[model samples]
Target: MSKARLLLATERRAIVGLAGLYATRMLGLFMVLPVLALNADHLAGATPLLVGLALGIYGLTQAVLQIPFGMLSDRVGRKPIIAAGLGLFLIGSVVAAQADTIAMMIAGRSLQGSGAVAAAIMALLADQTREQVRTAAMATIGLSIGVAFAVAMVLGPLISSHFGLAGVFYFTAMLAVLGLVVLWKLVPPAPRRRGHRDVGIDRGQLKSIIGRTDLWRMDASIFSLHLVLMAIFTAVPFRLVEAGIAEPRHGLVYLGVMGLSFVAMVPLVIVAEKRRKMKLMCLGAIGTITLSLLGLGVAGSGLVALVGWLFAFFTAFNLLEATLPSMISKLAPAGAKGTAMGVYSTSQFLGAFLGGVLGGFLSQQFGLSAVFLGVALLAAGWFVLMLGMTAPKHLSSEVVVLSDEHQGDALETLMARFADVAGVEDVMVVPEERTAYLKVDRSRLDTEALSRLTGVRD
Candidate 1:
């Protein structure tokens, strides 16, 4: 099995186009983060609580609609649902741009979030690529998101400074339009697929997925991570302004912090993956976030101190963001990955919603410092929870197509053989699906022999 064979030209096109589409959508959502807090006072009826609601209202809608949108995609085709989602996002952006009141702004943000196409896009990506190369394709999407976040953090303030918050909203609307165009023209059509757990949700497996302690831990980690992220943004801009950094210059701070943090993140990721120190690295990242938040709480009006703490915060954030999804994939059951991810995504959005609301209320009542202290407390709680988590195994799920001839007793024999294969930790053969789900260590697995046994090319 060569790399060229794994990723065909169509697969490459799907990967690049879909990654771009995902990044574009994410940019629209995140571009307001850096400037929203600064501009909130301008909107009519803008109390801290209302401002917080405007910032996080999108997550509430997203959390509510995400699974439903995914289920809808399964019924009416992925493209239609995705196109419709983008349309909803565009409409929301327009509404937000026209909003004069905080309530209207919240409505618009909620509409923007109503376009929940993440699961649909991922399922489409799975349909476009082969299993052997699917992980790489997914990784490309993840990379796109990280890049978009970094770019958005810098661009948000600059755009708002020049054209105002309404202008930023208009820009976001345009991005949504661009996403629709990309979906229609650039992304290839998803081929019909069956029994792919990586692609869509399985209702039957919900109980099992939710019941796993490891999965719950991962879910909680994501929830905590995003909660702190939204909460921090809710207050960080005010601190920057207080520290004498003008709103327009906020991008400079983000550029500096994000650039350095990314540089630091790469080596940590390499060590985590190559050295198999995932749990150690995860704990370290969590600890860093806790300390960074504490520093921000006490740093006061010092620009230098703020920058230093922000640098640490983002470095840890990038590492944790990158590692958590991988951890979920590794920890998920072979045939229930989609269900696990769906739940994980829901938790993440819910956290964003709660974080914004809570941060805003705290800041309003106790001041900006209180918001920082509150988030620090949350991060510390996350750190404590993570301490008891089991270290994730370094394994990849492999699907082997089973022939019709392997039935009943013969299938049982095949399953035994698969389990006996080197580096194969578990094997389950589903006769109804005519596929064998295998958990294997790629580092030690004999791919060639496995391919021979399953009559499939690796």
Candidate 2:
């Protein structure tokens, strides 16, 4: 196999810092998912509906604000927005720690979501790394999130069991503090402070991005995926307890299941990407999720059976989570990647909010099996939508920083020139930003031509 491209030393440092900052913040948010439903019963005004709301309240705020924040980062400095967001997250954590009611918990979680620094952080990462390595950097960040999620599932129950729910909130507050420190101390300064179309939301591209049917389907996929996730947790924790696992010992189950699921998922992911079977794999995973949910509802009375179904659910969930972003990257138009991702992310958060409310409502009214049944039906809907999706082409993005020499060129002229470049399938030139974005098939890329384009910058 050809050796992978290596990151520059500086790029390495920046990625580590940014990944750490992102992971710590996400860790703080996720550490409550698995334990909250079980522990929140003691809070005043607690109800299944309210608990679910508190569990997913962050997604509502996050969905509403991330795009705005990314756009704002173009005007103000990236660090300021990031720091301010972290401060809000810190305050929210403290508020939750002191809350005596589910209402307060909801308030705190909403505040936590309001931080919405994801876009700003991506912009910063783009500023720090060259285009060749930016995708890898983004992948690293994605991996960190997955890792944080898995760890949180295990840790949340353990901490809540030993120290109470307030302890988890307090721990998140400390994590926010640590995130702030990493942001400033470890993450390197961005070399340029400007809008990046590939990594930052572009207002001009929003309408176009939203109009693409394929992109919308990708967005819907994420929304369904996360909605099911948040909804499942609202009831699953209780089921584990009912199966005789103590609330405190819930982490052990998560650890075992998550570990095995990950191990089983790796080869499948490799097959999906390497063999060009993304569509087949995605469909299979969704089918697995539907079947697993059905199995859980029908025959999960025994602990062993319950664990088996849970493992299957998570394996499919993990695969979908890994593949969806990649599909977005492949299907999204070149220059509008940031805008496409912004819309996709908004859909994801909205799904989380709805999932929590709907899941809790079903569990409260009908029982735990009802929650699984409801989500299963929703997953079936997702599968149908996905079945109509055209297979995504294998493509990647290239960003070119325009030099002053291109200032006199017409936007159309520049775009035509870029489109004609060997292997480049699409091109977008924003003259105001003096940047060009291209979608290309790497195998067909003409290295000499690409070098000539970037080489023009002096």
Candidate 1 overall lDDT versus native: 0.89
- Candidate 1 lDDT over residue span 192-308, tens digit each: 845467657888888999999999999999999988899888899999999999999999999999999999999999998889999999999999999999999999999999999
Q: Give the candidate number with the greatest TM-score.
A: 1
TM-score of every candidate: 0.97, 0.95
**RMSD (Å) per prediction:** 1.5, 2.2
lDDT of each: 0.89, 0.88
Best by lDDT: 1
Candidate 1: where are CA atoms >4 Å away? 1-5, 404-411
Worst 10 residues of 1 by lDDT: 403-412
Which pairs clash in the backbone of model 2? none
